[model samples]
Target: MLPGPADTPPGPRLEAAVAAVAAPDVVFALSRDGQRTVRCGGTAPPPPVPRERLRYELGSASKAFTGLLLAELTRSGRLSGGEPAAALLDPRRRTDREPITLAHLITHTSGLPGLPRDFFRRALPAWHTNPYARYADERVVDAFLAYRQRRRPGTHWHYSNFGVAVLGHALAAATGVSWEELLTRHVLLPLHLDGVAPHPGPAGTDATGHRRDGTTPTPALDAGGFQAAGAVRGTPEDLLAFVEAHVRPSPTPLAAALHAVRRPVLRRGLGHRHVHTMGWFQHPTAYGPLYFHCGATLGQQAFLGFCPGTGTALVAACTRRFRARDTFVATAYGLLAEP
Candidate 1:
């Protein structure tokens, strides 16, 4: 019953933006003045739907949802960011690894590797396919337990997919719910994001992902236990709604939780001022600090960012995945830099 691209007419400004990026099947959404404008470019597949309705793998952008869930749990007094995450998991799962706090996981300072030690071993066979396809929850936990600390916990700002995935699992253990259910109940439902899915394939039309060639079907990341790391699938509209909440939070049930997530907690340098909040990276810009995150699957690239000074939030998604995928992120930063 949702409207497709034909029903939602796009303007020339959006057309120009997509063309400027040269991204195939690009969806762009901007929020300003309590209003939202969404549009898309490039070719779509059968049973055409509006680009706003086209869903793509969110990749690590899913980490923000996990971070929000942590904030919500904190707001409700269910958990504290300072607690040792190892204590929350089953004793058998705990190891001699240096203790990491929930805060470390949220800020990517847990000193865990970006991927599990065993990740490459398992992923190599399916390197071109879905690398995270069959990783089980138990295995994910075991990998965390076996991982040696690369540095003392909280001493470095290393981005670790393994750390976030462990955080998701620890929260699940604390809440007795799956990460997907926790996300839905704590974040998605409260935000009214009906278009977001727990995994790549779901009901309704999903935008077909592409390779650098712009034609090959990119494999969807059917991550299991690693789902927390990067498995969410959603449309640009849904992502815009999420960023809007960050830009201009209302007195919604999650206002306090949202505020908690955006609080600047860790600075990256002695005087550089680059910062990291719960799930967003704060970059110094002419328009003040821009809080943003970018995600990538095998074939899709997504960028979501918001500028507090301008009250503007933007989302850019490309159906094709390539080395230049970061170009979309650069494009988003440029858009924020606009006066």
Candidate 2:
């Protein structure tokens, strides 16, 4: 699987650790200070693209970008984070309790369910391949309007794809553009993530996603109703470029928003384990504050993390989805946690 011109990743543990994963291959990207490295590990056949340039589904990791967009829009005064999300929704349901705000949507404090209304009816039919392919835009808006919040907005931290998806929709509704267009205009272009998109791109440029067994290939997922929550496919090179901006001073337009996303926004859940920024999860490591997020499709997985104090950013991706065990997230976090 070591088939690219990319530099070998540093650390005594990284090479052996990433290479040992059982999937078709894992591309591990790392950057510390200003140095960068990308490495590929596995026995399966390599793709035509360079390891650093090969695209993998970012899944939920796309939320960090959504969070950045939220910050950038707020900073630009183009959109108000404190404004009610219902204002942008199609149905604009009247809630008697505290209304859900755009801030609540990005922070996952909007008391919405993880999946949309009647999701099981669609998901049950294609659970193994692509569950989200049928949950279209109209269904998503209907779900939001149908929601009844027993708990007030911002009272709890629930990771809701539905909530973030609505955030994407609301931003677009306010700006008179599509969610993909908003993300491209604000985040992707500013970071120079040239080929990254919310939907699938050209087929040959992407690594085929496979199930854990490494034999069954799964269909590429559409963000469909969850565009802001997931639905991005990108290369390790671009991903490292994206995470680096969080730890390194950037000349990009998103600099302030990048800094804004680093602040801890909320902590809720059992034992107070769920600490978060607008998009990324914040964990207090012995080294410093580490912000990270992981994403998964039916057949692929991705992870992104950065430690501001250590000046470290990392991305790890696998071509196959695991049923139970996941080595990428914890392993990448450990490498970044080490000085």
Candidate 3:
């Protein structure tokens, strides 16, 4: 079992950082040198266990998990990402552009758009609340089919929820199972991350969200077709545990895969200075390459990252996604990248 967040107290820097976020409730789970602690702040009181277990929507940080699943499947020889993802589609129609491989999907180089076409048709109605939840799985597939590739696959990097969601479907089509089951079997269960649930159940959670006011409640996004993109949700503990596994992966079920994710896979941004690993964005610092990915639901924000060089893992979660969410990201990144 991982060490509990109560084992140690956070440093002054972490405490002040957590307190700065404009949230009614927030938690910062920090692990360093194998010790961990959770700093709670904001107007709301610290949530108890179980309620605290799923209180934050992980948003795009979920891509890290998807990256892990892709690595594990590739490691186990389940589905070689080299195969064209189109083969897994319903009609399996060939496109005029270069064939998009499964690898391209996970790497965000599939030449797919950021969103599926006609997404706004349904999303506009629920723009402020759970937009992706309106795009059902079948409709998502149809959207993929309707889109014509504007850029050549593998030529450039463009983050696309459409690509990853399609990859989830392709994996399911290949394995004859759902992405949820695949994630549970190969990633979550093996890692003991039972709290990172994408769907709701009888056991209600304290994971509700709030708008910018930090008081008005906002509906949680239980993504329908976009589950693979960003539906993962859990407490700061759950996220810290996940990142901790990467920090010291030996003996873990996905140790090799975990190590593989940190290696720079693609380079992007100005002068190719930014690094893209299988799961996280890589930024080199005096400490080392800091790997991280952040996400936000309509009302909540989350940042997850770790630096192997400095041996740090940080998970920042909050109920309100204020306009200054980037400030939260900068603060979290500072915590991880601090030498």
Q: Count the backbone clashes (under 3 Å) in each candidate.
A: 2, 0, 2
For model 1, how does the per-residue alpha-carbon lDDT over 194-221 read when each residue is reduced to its tens digit?
9887875554468777877777886667
Candidate 1 weakest lDDT stretch, 10 residues: 1-10
Which model, 1 or 2, shows the larger lDDT? Answer: 2
Q: If scored against the real structure, what TM-score would every candidate get?
A: 0.90, 0.93, 0.92
Model 2: pairs clashing at backbone N, Cα or C within 3 Å: none
Tens-place lDDT digits, model 3, residues 1-339? 122243334566677787677677777788887788777777666655433465578878888888899899998998778877776775447544478888898889989988887888988888887788889998887888777778888888999888888888888888898988999899999999866776654445746788877888888676889888888887677778899999888869999899888888798878999789887898888777888998888888889988888788889888887785356777777777665
Instruction: For candidate 3, list the clashing residue pairs, or say none.
Output: 55-207, 60-295
Clashes of 1: 2
**After superposition, which runs of candidate 2 have C-alpha atoms over 4 Å from their true positions?**
1-12, 91-97, 269-273
Clash pairs, candidate 1, are 4-50, 5-50
Error of 3 at 238 (Å): 2.2
Q: Rate the local accuracy (lDDT) of all candidates.
A: 0.77, 0.82, 0.80
lDDT of 2 by residue, 1-339 (tens): 222222334743557657667778688888888688777876577667665577889999999889999999998999879877776775445544478889999988888988876898987787887788778887887788778786789887778999999888888888898989988999998889986878877867787888878878888886678888998888888888899999974666788899899888888768877688988998887777888998988888898999988788988888888765566666766676666
Choose the strongest candidate by TM-score: 2
Estimate the overall C-alpha local distance difference test score of candidate 2: 0.82
Sort by TM-score, top down from the best: 2, 3, 1
